[model samples]
Target: MSVVSMLTPGISMNSFEATAHVVTQLEVQRVSYMLVGALSSNAYGIPRATKDADIVVSFDSIGVVEFAKSLGVGFKLDRQMRMETITNSIRNIITYTPTNFDIELFRLSQDEHHKERFQRRQRRWLEEIKREAWIPSAEDVVIQKLRWKRRKDLDDAENILAVRAKKLDWDYLNHWTMIHNTNDLLKQLRDECPNLDVLDEE
Candidate 1:
């Protein structure tokens, strides 16, 4: 469902507003984070509405609970942290009281690609948030989505390949996909998208 449709009616805060508020809170807490999930995919691929915002955070200075508490009114942080099965990362959910929208904060994991992707994240102007925010590179988004291989994720990866064909760093993409055992899937996506030129410039 679209973010607007998912929001509670008569609420002043829309999905972008709720996401912006959560991002502002993270900035206030001085947490290092990168926007991910549907939002990240939307930046590179076809635009699609999302009900919630997902972020990967490095909580170097403060504990998770304390950070959530600091969000103060209009936000409630779940005390119970859960393991995300696909990535096996710990995540906490924060509910925006006004709109009942969820903001998922995934603790940065020690996985090799996770660390590399965070390091490679780029700052882009987010018109919705009215500020520059960190987001994964298009190649990383493609790699991660292919690794996940869910129906939606595969669709997202294919869309990204379709839209960002010429600009992609094929060598870097090939290396990681091979390491993650997603090279075949990547190849399949590329093959399926007839408009994507098979030749790599780099």
Candidate 2:
């Protein structure tokens, strides 16, 4: 089954509206952030259900927390410096009580791949909310997830590969995957998605 087929839920407009609101607020406050996770995945890959939107920001937790709190009211910062399981990277998670939506903020890392992905984010029309927003590229999404190596991340990577193989920058993807030791997993994802033949040229 394709990613859209295996995932049985539709995206929530309310979640997107909330994201747009927050994104606008962040920009107004001069915070640099790029949308990641399934929320942004809707751009190039299958639209999957997710309650939260993950963002990589140029600021750290301290700056992000202060900004989140000043956004009128109801946005609560839950945890700061929370380390993710597989990647061991720290994130600041803030929840909007009114919508129960989480915005997980990750600090931009010095890692080559992270820097590249953050710099490569492009503005695209988000159909979910009918607005343009900065979103990670399809290749970046796969690269980000596969580096994490979690079960769900793997599924997400596979899903992106299934639908966006031809569109991805294979050279860029392969370079980082080899550095991150995920080349085999990348190969497996391509193999699983039978139609992903673009990599065969390499």
Candidate 3:
């Protein structure tokens, strides 16, 4: 189902409303997208507060400026898009005026893992946004977080490992980690988390 159809208007405050607004616009344009970043981690890991919303979109039907314009008032799309070094993907930023919240729209990249994760995204009900949205799988979240390797990302990876160790597919996680040269990091994070008996067999 389209994200727009699942949304109930006025269900949240400014920050959440801003995210829902973006999701609504993406659905209206028929763009394929999946929510990522802290929100995605919160689903499989520990929940936390974040001022920004990250979404990876397969945007092609329209130009960024036109798409921004279509978002209507209270949203300003940055004209200067950036290239993310790790994934080598372009990202567009949007400022939701009311709450000063930034919504990051990343263009889906050609990376093998990026493609795999996007395809593997799962639909889940997000209480914060008061709607169902697509989010990365637990394994994918760990892989991507390790690849990013930021302090916060590592912390998130550790939490997800702690929460979903046994349920995660180690083979799939191992495969991507090997390809990305992040196997050692993944192993380290896994080692740090307690009660990961599932890693013993793998």
Name the lDDT of candidate 1.
0.82
Q: Give the TM-score of candidate 2.
A: 0.82
**1 versus 2: better TM-score goes to:** 1
Tens digits of per-residue lDDT for model 3 on 68-174? 88776777898898999989889999987767899999999998889999999999988788788888898999999999999999999998888888788999999
lDDT of each: 0.82, 0.73, 0.85
Better candidate by lDDT, 2 or 3? 3
TM per candidate comes to 0.87, 0.82, 0.90
Total clashes in model 1, counting residue pairs 3 or more apart in sequence or in different chains: 0
lDDT of 2 by residue, 86-171 (tens): 45457888776667888788877766677888788998777765567778888888988888788888888887887777777899
Query: Candidate 2 at 161: error in angstroms?
Result: 1.6
Model 3: which residue pairs collide? none
The digit string of per-residue lDDT tens for model 1 on 1-202 reads 1112233323567657767666666776778999999889988877777788899999988888887776556778888989987677899998887778889999889888888999999987666655667899999999999888899999999888888889999999999999989999999998887555543222
